[model samples]
Target chain A: MIRVQSEAFDAGAELNAFSTQAAGAGAVVSFTGVVRDVTGGLSGMEIEHYEGMTEKALGAIRADAMQRWELADSLVIHRFGRLEVGEVIMMVATASKHRKDAFEAAEFLMDYLKSRAPFWKKEITADGADWVASKDEDEDALSRW
Target chain B: MQVLYFAWVRERIGVPREEVETSAVTVNDLVVELRAREERYDAAFADTSALRVALDQELAEFDAPLSGVREVAFFPPMTGG
Candidate 1:
């Protein structure tokens, strides 16, 4: 499953739902990204995404993960628009018969989502706002898989 | 065809989307046409290496043919998660 929305979601509830739906899997691994206040005095973050393309890109990434790993199910939920600090930005969960598959798939999904997805984040502070630049480390992470 | 910009590219171009009519054959040619339009386009495209392009919502190379492409988007390297 893949979802791209502006509304906030409960990570715990979502995880439970995903686990319940991923029947027959022995191991499940999940990662949740939070809107942290990396800099002090930060007010909020604004996320902009290509509406038609966001879902398509996420679907492609999820499909790729499924092909690469022996999985029972997978889920990716990402939120856009204005989000305050401490909110959940996105989550990825993968289910497989073994822990190694689940862990590797989850990490692969996170790596691709960080650089391949078409979403841009802007950090808002008391002074002003600035677009978050893509880190070289993020791009370098893709070389592993 | 339709041209789209996102993030700082949109800010520089001052519009999210626009209809473009051109006889350009490839993404790079289309970019050249856009750069010739105004200073804003020139500045937005000043560093093609710092940007990325998509054709019909799928990532494409600058040398990719534009024929039959309905949408073209330009933006900086994604910072998603």
Candidate 2:
């Protein structure tokens, strides 16, 4: 499943929804990403995305994860538009028979999503606002894996 | 074709959306076409190192073919959490 929405989502509810349905899976690994108070020294974040394109991009990323990881299922949900601190911004769930596959797949998905997704985030700080750059470290991480 | 810009690229270009008609067959070719538009396009694409691309919303390579693509998007690397 893939969703790009403005409203904050319930991570616990989403994790339970994915895990409970994966009866054959022995392990379910999920990641919940929230709006942090500090990002690259910025105080707040505002994310913008083309709604239709955002969902389509996420669907493609999910499909790629499915091909790379042996999993029972996967779900990716991301929020767009303005977001406040401490709000749930995104989540990724991977169900697999082993913990390693499930955990690694979820991590891999998030790493790719960071640099590959269509969403753009602008940071508002005391000085002013600026769009965040795809960190070189992010690409390095993806390359190492 | 539909052209979309995001992040600093949008800010630098001064517009978020545009439509263009061109015969470019690859992403590299399209960038060359756009760069010819004006200083903003030239400056926005000055360094491919600072830019990334998506074709029909899927992350794509610079050398990727653009045939049959309805939308082409340009932006810097994403910094989403």
lDDT of 1 by residue, A1-145 (tens): 9999999999999999889988789799999999999768789999999989888999999999999999999999999999999999999999999899999999999999998889999999999999999999999999999
Per-candidate DockQ vs. reference: 0.92, 0.66
lDDT of 1 at A104: 97
Predictions in order: lDDT: 0.95, 0.84
Clashes of each: 0, 0
B54-75: candidate 2 lDDT, tens digit per residue? 8887778999999999999898
Pick the TM-score winner: 1
Candidate 1 regions exceeding 4 Å error are none
lDDT of 2 at A101: 88
Name the regions of candidate 2 deviating beyond 4 angstroms: A39-43, B63-67
Q: Would you estimate the TM-scores of all the predictions?
A: 0.99, 0.86
Q: How much of the true A–B contact set does each candidate keep?
A: 0.90, 0.71
